[model samples]
Target chain A: MISNEFYSQENHGPYELYSLGDFELEDGGEIPDCKLAYNTFGELNKAKDNAIIIPTWFSGTSKDYEAYIGEDRALNPNKYFIIIINQIGNGLSSSPHNSPDLMSMSDFPNVRIGDDVRAQHQLITDKYGIKEIALVVGGSMGAQQTFEWAVRYPDMVKRAAPIAGTAKNTQHDFLFTETLIEAITSDPGWKSGNYQSNTEIAEGLKRHANIWAVMGLSTEFYKQEKWELFGVDTLDEFITGFLQPFFQMMDPNALLTMAWKWQRGDVSRNTNGNLEEALGRIKAKMFIMPIDEDMFFPPRDCEAEQKMIPGSELKVVHSIAGHFGLFGGEGSYYHDQIDKHLNELLAIPVPDKVI
Target chain B: MISNEFYSQENHGPYELYSLGDFELEDGGEIPDCKLAYNTFGELNKAKDNAIIIPTWFSGTSKDYEAYIGEDRALNPNKYFIIIINQIGNGLSSSPHNSPDLMSMSDFPNVRIGDDVRAQHQLITDKYGIKEIALVVGGSMGAQQTFEWAVRYPDMVKRAAPIAGTAKNTQHDFLFTETLIEAITSDPGWKSGNYQSNTEIAEGLKRHANIWAVMGLSTEFYKQEKWELFGVDTLDEFITGFLQPFFQMMDPNALLTMAWKWQRGDVSRNTNGNLEEALGRIKAKMFIMPIDEDMFFPPRDCEAEQKMIPGSELKVVHSIAGHFGLFGGEGSYYHDQIDKHLNELLAIPVPDKVI
Candidate 1:
């Protein structure tokens, strides 16, 4: 894989590695010496009914989900055993930037949402020997994997919260993601998926940052000068000082890998493009949560998919932060709102899978 | 002058050029010798009271307004004298790629919206000797100029209609335009705006095209497979064949110049950034038209600005085409609605300027 100093364990703190030993991807390629980086909280009790899985989002690591965990939080450390799994291609996981063998850089196999979910499935069942999960939850790409978990292993996941994401990625979203990919790949410093250092692709990274600057946050966020909430005094500073450099630190190959998979997220492929049939297979108590202003995953798109799932409820959370509200970036209110939704879903007793 | 073959008279048919001698920009830069490209239809009545000025939008030319000039159209050639003036930096006019002498290529001055209106006013007043104009109308960047015309020369413009644009660019829109600029400049081939041919910067143009693919149209347009209306069979074709190539034909420097001005459009600048005070100066009967689904100028954003303009009407047009509806790309219903609004505005007689 393309070795970039940025994606090393030295940069990201306190995450354990679970080796899949050359994991075969659903697309017929394998990540050489594949490893899924993860973290655990609390402990599994007698029957392991208290297990919860928190899948990481795009560009996120296992450690990024710490905001959602605490004794007082919905994902209570004392009450449930929580596992934070970083999806493949998110740098910390066996990604284009961190692979150690023949499959490296752009040669890294194209991974799908299904592949990511299957890997998590393998880790949860084989490593922990847990037959059932109390909850499977995540936001954005994590949400896509959560949908995959519920649909692929219906009997295993009792409750699913796919927040701010969709099972079948919309055509518009595919194009949006295409722009993100174009931003990096088109950079001359990219050198056809091989670059010396992150600094070389500086201009391209800034372009990617501008794309996010436009679509990542809701229009209301800009209209209200909400960057002020983040202590950014001027719009120029918001771009140069914050967004650009934050993204500049990321490996271009890592971003591209995740973006490619994100654009192709489609659980409906399991049922020959019949989303109705695919979502119908979900036995999990599903709460499809969408942020109202999320331009990436608008509430209507999430609601459409939610309608396909039997007994699923569409929960629209309010936030001017848009897709970024998932990270509780500009608003603290969204954090409480998300916790409330999670607690409500947890409180509903899921009917045990009938054999 | 860079002298690209694509923007030559050999390509776009039948438009005249007017010399401005030397033009001074609002930003304190100067073009050695400037020219404005324009087209006119019908005969100016003896009193010159039937004249109408149509300013071109971003990346658009004078010939592009022909769709609105049919015999039975609201801008019926038989009834009103129509002049379509291509804005400076829009390739056909004096721009980065087409200028001659010291102000050639990237050395071209940073022309503002006011500079464009001032040039148009000079052309109309000096050559055409047009006074007490019946109407001034445009869409998008054209709409920006329309607002400027109404504010800068209120007594001259009797009726004003600005469609799918704002009096001042919003912070999000500012950032959105920034991405469009980044797409081209970030390309190594761009060479700081001195690329020899459009083909040299193919990757950057493609990136710019992808950016448009995301924000230029409504998500509903994609959701409904509306590209079918344009005879496209697949999503990939719609992007690669339609969107990408359309932008590829343009000069990147020309696009950048227009986009820079577009992001800074503010009639309120005349009043030291007090939008209400600036818009209040308009004596022309005004109608602000916003496409309901326009992501760039959402009706809410347009309505907010419309509220500041005294007696101005906010007419929300229905278009799944989003901001591209200004060009009538996917729907003709918007054209009919736009014409209906124009005709309604044109029907209202102007109050005599008390000179």
Candidate 2:
């Protein structure tokens, strides 16, 4: 097993693990003594009604969500108690990297967005004694989970903001995810998910990063030389300095785990594959926001799902950063737009009486 | 070294090797006794002016072009002496797979599209005693060679038809090529381009095919389930039965060699990085065709370059097969269009006297 320091909360702190003991996966595999790593800010109010939940995206930990959580941001910790839950397969959570031998890398169970939301539901309702969430928000795989929460437990989620992600995986997105997975696993160093060290799979990780460089950002990003904003002059410098280093630190198995879940993300799976019927069950004040330049989750795809969900509003955020725009890097124009829409969703009136 | 049976003319027949004797590469490396394998159909006319040259694309052999060369096809053997030259790095030619030890696999020099065209010029002008080519046509990497032929020896090529390819590699296409190259090299079984057998790098080759599946075809291909036309019921079947088997037969090093050439295919490099100046040198009657659904070489990119080339016409082939549409499978709608265009190009009036 790898060292705990790689996934420990020592650096990006204030994390807690909620043990779910022998959690059952959607695919019928079980993770013995399963635990979810999460971070919380502010305190649950007297009524336990001011709690907001944010799930991490693929390859992202709860700590990565800190940028969006601030006094004046969309996920204001000052206004509500914010709980950032790391999705299973993210190293910080119950993932392939940190699990026991029986549930380790090669043996890790298949997890879906539904399973992650169910675990988050357990953490919020059973552990924290929270009856309802003020808002459930995220982007990419996080957005997938947000959609799951809205449909799976409609009454429990008052408002839902799913940014730059779809309720279901499109064929194009599935193919893209397949390429990312193949890029990692095809590395002989991967040893069919039994590599000794992350360093061994360096070339594969580099290829994975290259895939992201092409699809994660729009062509406009390269044409405009947006890497200049990231302090890189050439594409090679951007890939080596930024993309390579970031993905190199990650466990390939953990990434594969999240990617599998990402590929299988479909709210309609819970309702016999009837997407319209599944989306119609959403009682939350829904804000379906998509990045205009995002190749993976284009606005056309988001608006199609939004039109099916009763009372759901489709908000498009325009930026050359493409899907990465949702993460809100320095000088990102869409951050304010996302903040405005999220605030609007949060302000929607709910029933004064508790359920 | 692996057996020559895989690349021999016995199975994929009628090919002959032409020795170039210590060919010099654009990257300053040299291959001693360099040779190119080619197949010719029909007899060279008395005038020796009816020859049409077709260069192979990435992973394609001379035999693969046989499908488009029949009595009623675009490359009719009866009317024109069609010379199908296997691009260097394509196994039958002077590739990493078949070269002598000093210039084999890891030692093979980086080849450019211009170098291939220059060699083809030598083969046509010196070996065959052909003064001018009636036409130079191809798709994808083959199209890259067509562009090189038109610009490098403008007077030698009477007409040029480059389909589903660009004169210069776009940032998007360059990134795609990078992924393909990385996918092969990252395979530990690849052993730094010295794998003992094709089976050793199976995973990497499979990944290479997967990338082609995603980018080589359009979203409509998956949505419409066009693989069904290939007699597969599921995506897994399509991948395992079709994609894997197709790529498993090739040499990884050979693929990488061709990919490097594909990535560096910029006619502007010959004209001091001035694309307009390079395109202006084209004396060939040019018909630039792009596949509408091709994500790698979109029609817009092709049309932009077509406008820069003097006397060039842009023709868009609308199809969901994307880049693969150029190969013209069973019941392909665009094959007739391509045939009609090629016939029209062949019918164009030529100078009364030869140069």
* Per-model TM-score versus the true fold: 0.96, 0.89
lDDT of 1 by residue, B106-142 (tens): 7887889999999999999889888878889898999
Candidate 2 chain B lDDT trough over 10 residues, lowest sum:
B326-335
Model 2: per-residue Cα lDDT at residue A278: 98
lDDT of each: 0.86, 0.85
Model 1: CA > 4 A from native: A1-11, A353-355, B8-11
Q: Cα deviation of B292 in candidate 1 (Å)?
A: 1.5
lDDT of 2 by residue, B1-355 (tens): 5664667677667899998888888889787888889999999999999999999999998987887888978788888999999998889889887887878878888999988988888888879899888999998999999999999988878999998898988887889898888777777798988777878988888888888877787766776678765567887787789877788878888899999999999999988999999999998999998988786787877888999998889988877788887667534476788888888888897665456
Q: Write the per-residue lDDT of candidate 1 for residues A80-163, one digit (tens) a residue.
A: 999999999888888877776566776788899999988988898889988889999999999999999999999989999999
lDDT of 2 at A124: 88
Fill in the DockQ of model 1: 0.79
